[model samples]
Target chain A: MNDMARLQKQRLALYGWMLVAPALALMSLFAFYPAIATLWHSLFTRGTTRRPSVFAGIENYNDLFADPTFWIVVWNNLIYAGITIPVSIIFALAMALWANAHIPARSFVRSAYFTPTILPMIAAANLWLFFYTPDLGVIDQITGFFGASPTNWLGQPETALASVIMVTIWKEAGFFMIFYLAALQTIPPDLREAARIEGAGRWTYTRRVLLPLLMPTTIFVFVNAMINSVKLIDHLFILTKGGPNNASKLILYWIWEMAFAYFDSPHAAAMTILVLLTLGLVAVIQFRLVEKRTHYR
Target chain B: MNTALASRPAKRALPDFDKVLDALGAWVLAIVWISPLLFATWAALQPSGTALGLDFSNPLTFENFTYVWNAVPWAGYFANTVVLVTLILAGQLVLCTLAGFAFARFEFRGRDTIFILVLLQLFILPEVLIVENYAIVSKLGLFDTALGIGLPYMASAFGIFLLRQAFKSVPVELEEAARIEGCSWMGVLWKVYVPAAKPVYLAYALVSIATHWNNFLWPLIVTNSPDTRPLTVGLSLFGAPETGVDISVISAATIMTVAPLLIAFLIFQRQFIQAFLRAGIR
Candidate 1:
């Protein structure tokens, strides 16, 4: 009887371990292992062949700090994130308000706004590349219609980076609008009615009630949008290759170039470490904001 | 008496004004929202020679579609993408469920610490670690394989966090009742926990598929050869500098690549919007 009881206990313990085993194992290998290995790679120098590598201490990181291109990439990323986040958030809120209003064909308008969100970033980039073409694209034709000279949207150093940022905002705004819409739904209907009964103006109600209520959603959007801006590189590759003299060079794009184009694995790893550190800082800010907001709520 | 009555009327009058303003604003916004997409669809139909032409006289043609298909291996890409997305989803569902349950129910030591560490992974994205990840994949002999491409995302922190939240909401009494009835832990999970979390599972599935379907950089790096390359990466090769691609052909290719998801979104927009809202609740 005791032996049977021991057997049952063993089986239950086995079952419990099995339940958590797959998750722990997969995460350890894929997520945790790669992250640790990346840190290791940063400390190593590449040998003659790609396969062989040796420990090289802080040299890779040293090269990163001294490189002018590294600074340029960092500057570009900051400018891109700074411009895109606020613009996208404002646009998203405006769109959500428009959609949430008693509009004719509201459903159609909502889907139309979100159409770009469903499209792949690469595909959208390609489509926009067509429009940005100087000689044969649609944007040039539109300019010509207005009797203006055709602009080399992607070809020029000055316009290329701005063009990329614009496309990103256009793609992201409507998607963020959905979050705003959800937040809008959660607002009690009686509040809006009571505001109306109290003789509150539209702008007054929006400022006093809606904006404050939307604060959490706005913060959430800001964090995700910032993360996206830092990580976005697909469009850069097809759009300009960080060029018209590397005007559009972002940190991640530069890391890709370092690893694949330059075949400098150590330098790429070092740059990646920097990107990770930046992300960590952003995350800290996000957590503090979230905690403070929760307290306010 | 007249002045006091007039003021109350003004209060009622203000809502009427707001309504009119909202209605007008909605129509104006709708037109602006729809125009760019309508223009893109219009342009997609035009031939290369006349696509950029300002004239509206040239009729729409299917030649661009023909050109796109013949120019790229889109069929092969479509097949590879299906395999990749499906494999990733299957792996994630199982892994996330287990981890989520563990975090939600188990009284294991250091649980919060380990879970917090997992959540920290959200900040350290795979893109930033792509260089070393590639090295790791090559070492494991998973390069040029769908499993390799999907491996990085299989244990998603978002999924774990989301499912954990949902699992926690299931009543403890229900779990206890199942235990009293001589139900095994696995039976309770399958019978009670999963059933209760069905809506969350659906929402997570859609989000996962949408994300992985549109994923570009990692798959581009891991899968080099055409046999393994997904649609986005495959389409890149078609438009490489070595091969001069016309604007119309590229647009056609773009449409082909994005059409499936767009069509699905249109068909199930209600569900899509609902799922998206659920995700936002996070």
Candidate 2:
């Protein structure tokens, strides 16, 4: 009887392991393993003569720290995130409120707003490329209505980064609005009615009621938006290629150029570590911010 | 009395100006959002010479699309993308459902820890480790295959996390009764847990399909040949520096590449909205 009980327990253990083994193995190989490998690769260098990788004791990282383009890319990433997240979130919040309000054709309006979110960024960027053309774009045509000369929207360094930022906002705001809309629906109407009974004006009610209800959703949207701004801005490859003297150069685009374009895999790997650390710091800060808010909510 | 009055605001109590402004605001926003699609449609239907001229009155024609269709092997691109997305979805559904069931129903030790680890993986997406992943693909000799493109994303942390939450909401008594009736574990899972979680599955499917279909970076990195390239990468070939293709043909190709997904989305607009809502909440 003792032997049979032990066998049964062992069998269950084996079954559990069997069920989870495939998932764990894949996650480790694909996600966790690469993360650790990138960290390791950052510390080494390919020897100058043979291109054989040798332990360089963080010299690659030192080179990365000293590079001017690296700093420019860093600043560009910061500016990109700073501009994109807040503007997109605010716009999304307003859109969500407007859609959630008792407006006519709300469904049609919501679908139209949400359409851009699903379109492939590459395809949308192509569409925007046409829109940004100096002579052919609609924007140029509209500007011509006021007797202004055609301006090179994407070709000029001054407007290149902002142009990319604008497209990013257009692509993301509607999607973020969906989150705000969901959160808005969960805020019971009774609470708003109670505020109304107390003579709270629309501004007062929004400041005192809706905004507080939306704090958690706002944090989620913010962090997700930040992640996107950092990780998924690949449309630069087609639209600008970080061109016009690297004015639109972003960190991921830089990494792509280093790896494939310049054939500097080791340097690319090192820069990835910097990118990873930046993302990690931001994620940690976001986690801390959200954790504090959870106690009060 | 005040509560009643507030709950049912009198029709004449508020100024009608507020509602009128709201309507105007929504209409203006919708038109702005739809203008890009409108513009793209305009560009894609016109001839190459007149396309860049923005001659809206030149009248619509099917010539640009047919030109693009013959210029590229779009049929191959569409087939590859469909196969890739379907395989990824089918894999995710089975894997996520099983893992979610295990975490939600089983009393096994270390389950909570493992589930938290899975959630953590969501933040550490594979994109961050692209260099090492590329090496892994090359070493496995799966480079340039749809299977390679789909393999890394097959087991999604988000899907598992979501489906587990869904499964936990299933009543325990339902499972117990099935057990008492001599039903096997798998049978109970299929009979009770799955049926109860249909909506969650549909929501997950929609999100997964949209994501995989629109994925550009990974596919761009993996696929080096035209035979295996998806639409986004195929569109790039037309825009290559060497091609010198006209903008009208490029727009035509872009429309052809994205139209299937767009049309499907238009038809199932409500489902897409609801799925996004459900995903956001989860």
Best by TM-score: 2
| CA shift of A112, model 2, Å | 1.2
DockQ of 2: 0.53
- lDDT to native, each model: 0.82, 0.83
Per-residue CA lDDT of model 1 for B109-195, tens digit only, reads 566877887888888898888887888789889999998999889888888899999999999999999999999887898989999
lDDT (10s digit) by residue, model 1, range A38-64: 788889987785567778899899988
Question: How well does candidate 1 score on lDDT at residue A70?
Answer: 81
TM-score of each: 0.92, 0.94
For candidate 1, the per-residue lDDT at A233 reads 75
Tens-place lDDT digits, model 2, residues A101-156: 87779898888889988888888788787778887688888888888999888889
Candidate 2 Cα outliers beyond 4 Å, as residue runs: A1-9, A47-51, B1-14, B240-243
RMSD in Å for model 2: 2.6
Q: Please list all clashing residue pairs in model 1, or write none if there are none.
A: none
Deviation (Å) of A121 in candidate 2 = 0.8
